[model samples]
Target: MMESYLELKKRHQKEVNEFPFGFAFSPAQFVEMMRKWGLDYEKDINKIVSIGNGGYVQKKDRDNMHEMFSRHRKEIRDFISADESGEEFVYKMFLREMRNYGYGWTGDPKDTLEALGLTWEDVQNNEKLLNGFNKASEVALRKVI
Candidate 1:
């Protein structure tokens, strides 16, 4: 199961790295990926809730995360409003958020991406970007675990 998750993670990372501008995954795709990884989505969701309760995100980091999420949302909205295809805008937004907040999905990013018509690959690339995303994700995972 861990290996499957790792494989999915790697695939997601590759997609992000390759596109860095497209971030769309249908709900089915997202859920299927999770299922394929042997994760019970509900359990993971509960784990996230537990992590929040545990407070490992820290007040400061939580505030920072909110700020980051807000900024990314605004950026995406502005980008979308500027004459691009909704899909393109969405893909950019997904990449932006994943690039900034990390891409653990938890479902939010994937939903947002689907709404905007982007894919995971659209927003992931560059050694620095991937490293940063993974680092953030690792932190989140550590908190949850």
Candidate 2:
């Protein structure tokens, strides 16, 4: 079943609200957290996640992840600003994609992923084209909280 916006927010809040400071974490732990919360992860094959690699999310890896996240965030924001109706356009396209992907009858975020033909791998590969939808989902998800 698809997770509700409230449910996602609740989970996100639960995890981040009390995140420990100065507590070191391995990439595996972070991946586990994401999985527990139904988040898509592109870090599956990382050596650190496997415990056989460096065993921690190394500084370089952490920096790379931050860079990737920033890039996607900027693209989404840019898309939303490029057109006066940019936000509206993403929502419209999200709805259309949902319908096209056979979720025409529902408004679910999981369905949104499916509608856009996105797996985490797909998102990783085609983020420029689809991150706006992802960003829109994040905005909507956060707003509900």
Candidate 3:
């Protein structure tokens, strides 16, 4: 089941990379996505929380959060590598990471672009489009989690 979930996650990550922007996912959408990934929310939530809370820092269970972020990064990297979308995959991967790891206003487009080796100017140039994409992903994430 874990392998199946991982495989499904890999496939979705690939799809996310290939497309990068434009898809609007909701909480229901995410639940469906998870289902497709072979993940059972009831069974996996605690594990996800545990993984998400792991970190090197010590502050209100910061380590656990850091650990989750670390796991998420690894998963993102694996998915990005398997993506067939070429260079665009990197951008898409960053966006996905931002949505998953970034919280509140910190999930800005500039931050996401910088994380992807892009400059603010690059994001500024494509502001309208990226904002839409980011909003869509964020909304979907909020609904699912």
Candidate 4:
């Protein structure tokens, strides 16, 4: 009974896909949610669209989606606290996403990294983005001193 993100967005007239501070929901989060809802992650991926945008979910799945969001709120909150810098959080999540789901960016998808205003090279060479990546990495590695 999870609602498609688009449905929820239209209903609320707000963007609810990303965490309030930064970071999109992690793939692990989505996998856990699917498990909770007794959904097959592989077979039911279409049920999720906000991950990278596009598509819609069946109205029947609305309640389950709401339940998942309600339960996962804490995880998002934790991510905000840990990320500190919103852009770093967003980059880390986006990198995780790119690794988990092949972007298939060849089709000119509207939601590809390039379409989203970034690139792997940008992360590597752009001073601002690279610094964010380095900071996030240091935190991930527990190298903060």
lDDT of each: 0.42, 0.47, 0.47, 0.47
Which portions of model 3 miss their true places by more than 4 Å? Answer: 1-60, 87-111, 115-145
The sequence of per-residue lDDT tens digits that candidate 2 reaches over residues 37-130 is 4444575434333223333343335555556546644544454345354345444455445545544334365766764435656545644435
What's the distance in Å from true for residue 80, model 4? 3.1
**Cα lDDT of model 4 by residue, 15-110, tens digit:** 345322112266776566667656677997665444234223434555655666664554433443455454555445544434333433322222
Predicted structure with the largest TM-score when compared to the true one: 2
For residues 96-137, could you state the per-residue lDDT of candidate 3 as single tens digits? 646655633454555555555556665446544355345545
Between candidates 1 and 4, the lDDT winner: 4
Question: Between 3 and 4, whose TM-score is larger?
Answer: 3
Any runs in candidate 4 off by more than 4 Å, and if so which? 1-65, 86-89, 103-145
Question: What TM-score does model 2 achieve against the real structure?
Answer: 0.31
Q: Could you tell me how far off, in angstroms, the CA of residue 40 lies in candidate 1 after the best superposition?
A: 31
Error of 1 at 61 (Å): 2.1
Off by more than 4 A, model 1: 1-55, 84-145
lDDT of candidate model 3 versus the reference? 0.47
Error of 1 at 93 (Å): 7.3
